[model samples]
Target: MTQSPLHILEHTFGYREFRGPQAAIIDALVTGKDALVLMPTGGGKSLCYQIPALARPGVGVVVSPLIALMQDQVDALRALGVRAGFLNSSLSPEAVRDTERALWAGELDLLYVAPERLIQDRTLELLHQCDIALFAIDEAHCVAQWGHDFRADYLRLNVLHQAFPQVPRIALTATADVRTRQEIIERLALEQAEQFIAGFDRPNIQYRITQKNNPRRQLLQFLREEHSANAGIVYCLSRRKVEDTAAWLCEQGFNALPYHAGLSPQLRQHNQSRFLRDEGIVMVATIAFGMGIDKPDVRFVAHLDLPKSIEAYYQETGRAGRDGEPATALLLYGLEDVVKLRQMLGQSEGSEEHKRQEQQRLNAMLGLCEITSCRRQTLLRYFGDNLAEPCGNCDACLHPAETWDATEAVQMALSCVYRTGQRFGANHVIDVLRGSEAEKVLQFNHHKVSTYGIGKNLSAGEWRSVFRQLMARGYLDVDPEGYGSLRLNPSCRALLRGETAVHLRKDAKLAAPEAPRRSPARDIDPVDLPLWNALRACRKRLAETQGVPPYVIFHDATLREMVARRPVTEAQLLEVTGVGDSKLARFGEEFLAVLRAEDYEGAI
Candidate 1:
């Protein structure tokens, strides 16, 4: 008799139950049906396919885009006593031959390959000779040409369905919007597959977006106040910024590293390895990083510039707090970021239609940043999910923004731009409005205009906010050809005529100074601290010996459970989550000794 999926789940993976449609999706795959799974990060999407792969007769072939992470994944599976191996560019020819022999001998349960390798004729022939369980395509969003993470190799993945129509295929991604979802379905030829759309919300993450005022200082404040001893990722818009930020953070005594395309491959790999293996290291990077990073305990993800679209922002921020522990997603944006982003988009070479579509996406992202309502709800709604109520965890919910009518201010700003010939950028128009007697203002003769000095009531920052909101709301437009000069859009006509009343959120004067909120995951009792630290030290030592990430040894959650339960015997240890049979037989006695020693000490 074959072991049931539930039996495998308990004895192999050691989880008590499946989470959020995992069981249904697993059942569908185990029974030889195609599936398109849309699950969030840390949502156990891997389990949906892994368990089915085990239950089925043949090895599961996983197509992954991340070459760097393949070894990590295979190492983790090997630790679980699963016969998993990867074939990629990183392997030697002898190692590849050995893996092929294992596959032919049916000695492997799962195999991971890159899309480029999987599409090779020889590789396809080898797969044809095996009794394949299924094909799992991770990061399916890369198939969409317009997606931020597009990979040309992914476009050829449709051949999987064409070549092996009988074998089940599952396409999984955590960051697909509605259009991208449709594109995935059409491109992958999974039109008939069962679609499992999980909720997009990551309730464990607390979202915060602040106007970028002294952005470096704001980032420092966040790190010191909230994530002093935690692992995090800081995303910048440029490679130079990433290098500079990483260097500055290191000077400030942070375990910081930079990752980008421009870095030498050796340096990039070394930095990524250090970040994965060590604790409390912060990786400052451009969008080039964090596609397939499996680190589960990242405490925060901060953005130093505006992302290109809501999908891009969501995907980047979703990297935080994957362990279901409380985490922070901080974004700092200023008028300059908007102007730079707009300029970039304008200069990008694409069809007019494509450019228009990208601009619309940018506008949507700007709306999300400027929205005064619930950030989470607004974010989910963009992905076609509607929350019944506002999430109480985001900054907007914690500190509701206060709005004030900006009718007269909007009129004055628009009139100033118009009267100044609409060829000047926001800085010049702002200077003219604020009655600046600067040389440029006099050279442009804007001080003599009737609109000059009409807006002295607002500060430079306040006027900048008004202009940003106006652009975000479509009341103003940027003339890319005119060097980012401000122009009045048709929407401004209504505001100019007093036919519409515009209200804007009062930008917070400064980021509030507050300690990081305590999280349940980190709420170990005073007495348990010593034991927790000891357990962590033991895990770290073992991880070093094994050359695998500590989380691969055991997650922090599992460690916390061991501390809380203080299991004395093998049976009790087995009762703890994540302590599978292989781990029990391997390191059970070592952990039991730690617990027993701690218990004895407490008695003393």
Candidate 2:
């Protein structure tokens, strides 16, 4: 059997060899078999369609969702000497016309179009005239109503095959659950297409969700630890928060910028460009900042507010560590996030069915936050995937979560809430528990309550944990209808009767309680910014080259080591922390070249 030179060429211009589903996906497309690729965020997904598009006869049609992605992908492809162009709202009419002319003239290798534009009759008519190789639906999960960035325009993608039935179509998405995958299949009318699910586990990402007590300070700590690398995305719930957080981050002397729907398109583009091209810019944005985005070196993804679902969480966290080096997803939440989220949920304008599905999604996100077991396990389970053991990469696994029989403490707490007339949230109730003689305690006469001064031994943080855990464990519920008052749940009866043990797990801190003091300015990697960047370019090129996902070769840790060590030989590579024998032998040559050919040395 003759190997198609696409496999060989894949290594040449692209970088690495194909691994796992990549070759099969390329083969499926090369053979004109329509396919759906359900790959994780950093899963070498772009190559599945891109390589085959370049390998086979004519221009590959890639239907992308975001304007930023189209620009960046085209730029990257052009850098590697592959002809690429995009037709989206961002392009002028003349640009779109010239791109269409190029498509008809067969001057471009890959053509990316927004789904809305792809659906237009004029575009379809022009596409029909071209010797189209394949139709690649990027971000295919947007077809589902259950998706975080649902695009009604994606529903039109199904008609593509009907118009150009002979052309093979490959639908792809970075994050899609079984439901969303199925929806993409049905909607695209590709039921017979081969389904390729690259591994969902992002082993390099350290997944963590911290309680949102003083999120600003907590965010500062994460930046301190991870900012030695490119500062990562900090996602907030609202446009206001995005602006506020971005401003605050800048004040702290980080090159942070804001991006949200509310921003002028020019500003959003400017912020995105700064993040994409420059190093160490923390783009504080809403979820709008990252879909279909191809930024491989985002060191961390911090959530300043609650994410709505497991899919949304997976997609957002998935953005970090895409380069397969160790990145972090630091999510900060409080009990009030649920209330605030549910309030937002309750206000959404949609069919009742949509609302119900959204509620289920939010509930799943809340469960992930509340789960005491391995967080990665819960996250995988939510996507209808399974993991055998604790990930050992998340907060729960890093520090084994502590659980105490809170049956008595919960009983006292719930009974106290009930006695206090069930009108107060956790803070006020905790005030009563610790016998705070503050004005509210004295005015409401909570100081005289039976629970007052009974738990003075518990620290303020510990008491907050008790309340959060109580709410999570279902002994209490936050009544969104009642200004977030703590209401006694039916489980409280069993706890109050001492028949059931109310297990309360302590909320883990942002950093270890005993960790050393950190310098605010020390967060920036003034030491080796130039070196780390070259290693990052290595990761990105290697990811693009071998059809094998970037993370599989060497994690960000290994790359950082190569940069920090300036490893020039295989032996030196072995000495790097994350570069084991197999990885060193495999990627040693590529990485050495990356280090030797360095402009970033002066950047340091």
Candidate 3:
């Protein structure tokens, strides 16, 4: 019997199978045809190109926009004894020269390059000189106008095919709308590409939201009980919030790190690297943290703040369960998150119409967070796919949701917004519902309003449910400019007049008594012990030396990996997943310095 290339793909890439439409995409690419591969996160997206690359006759040029640098990727490949190299601005003249020499000598299998470098005059000339295989544009959605990480560099991708018209090109993205699919094809010059759209369902990831009450405590409880210190990323809306949340996690004895744009470039890079190592380090960061990151073992992605849109939420959450392991997307939200998200969008630099579209996307995210029916069904429906039941893996499934008939509650909440002229935020509305006689409440004369105290039947918590559910269901809109004041959208007219019946799912129930805390995070042994200050020092040193995302280098995974393996040498050190070439060469010495100081070596 003769061995097929797919058999070799399974052994070399550590995969035994091709998933979803992967076989078709690989077939097309191998036949010298262009392709568009759209698989969800954790789906075998890389195999679509990797398998074809190895099967093809020449070096595969994978143009990627991952947050890591050339050193990180090239090293990972080299560690596996696969001949791979990356060319980018971050590489030194000597490294770049060596890589080019290897490429020309046919010593490289895959050559990873930033899109900018791939389109350079010298680079294109070099490509012309070398025998090129397929060109894979990873993170293909960045070329799409609707994508979160839209980049002008991606727009230049068409030049690759234009310059080498015969080269097979494959564009891969985890998330894309129909419009984005078209944009990617047009932008990447893959006009004749075969398109493979995989299911967007992440059945293994549980989705849940905790009402924001003592949010700090709720977050702590969540991490402690359900999502502990596993390879998780905690999203914050601001740099300050990122810092504070990271600090809070530290206090709770979680191996947590903070990442934001405000950090030095080197610091961000190091933090990113750490997170990717994947032992388990909680990374608290803003929206800048994830874009084309390749780490596959993230256990959970939690949001302390509302994400800007459903696309962002989906992409971020998709970061979890990349290893085909079960994960969760837990959002700890309140009515306030909606307002803040709206405010940020409203004040964004884009045009009015852009803001409008952004609002629609945000509304979609809000709807998903608030939905009670099958979480899987709603998400797929949005992407023009549908599922029939709640994915058993989600919070909605573990704790079956109860419904609250809000017919009269909706009218009261809407009347409050309407009488308040829809100018006030949730705080003011809450005050009116509870009939608070506080100074601000009286100053606005909200106490005298007809709708005031009408919601007294509901507790402050219950009233919040009314409004938040209304906003999620499209009966109301949040004013983005004012940090989320309630506004009457067109859908509200019928609802406010009692012409429509409104219902919302009761919030997810707490874990049952005697049940172990819901998350694998409790398996951590820090016992909430103090490792934060130590972790920060380790994070700082790693970031300063390696010029990539600290999260990428030592993400939650690396930190936990460090704690578990305690690698003591260059030999043992390379075992960490995210420890790349630049990072190993740069910080490898200092990490040894720590191990020697603590007399720590691999034991866990």
lDDT of 1 by residue, 1-604 (tens): 4578998889888899999999999999999999999999999999989999999999999999998889899988888889999999988999999999999999999999999999999999999999999999999999999889999999999999999999999999999888899999999999899999999999999989989889988998888877888899999999999999999999988899999999888898899999999999999999999998999999999999999999999899999988899889999998887887888888889889889889989999999999989999999999988899999888888888999999999999999999999999999999999999999999978889999999999999999999988888877878878898988898789889999998998998445533374333368988788788778877887899999999998999999999889899999999999999988887788788888883534422
Q: Could you say which candidate leads in lDDT?
A: 1
TM-score of 1: 0.97
User: Over the stretch 11-61, how does candidate 3's per-residue lDDT look in tens digits?
Assistant: 354334666788888889888999888889878787788778778888899
The lDDT values for all models are: 0.90, 0.76, 0.74
- What would you estimate as the lDDT of candidate 2? 0.76
Q: In model 3, what lDDT does residue 276 have?
A: 66
Ranking by TM-score: 1, 2, 3
Q: What is the clash count of model 1? A: 0
Candidate 3 deviant stretches above 4 angstroms? 1-4, 67-69, 227-229, 480-483, 508-604
Q: lDDT, candidate 2, residue 205?
A: 85
Prediction-by-prediction clash tally: 0, 9, 41
**Per-prediction TM-score:** 0.97, 0.83, 0.82
In candidate 2, what are the lDDT values of residues 506-545, reduced to their tens digit?
7767764223223222223777666676666676676567
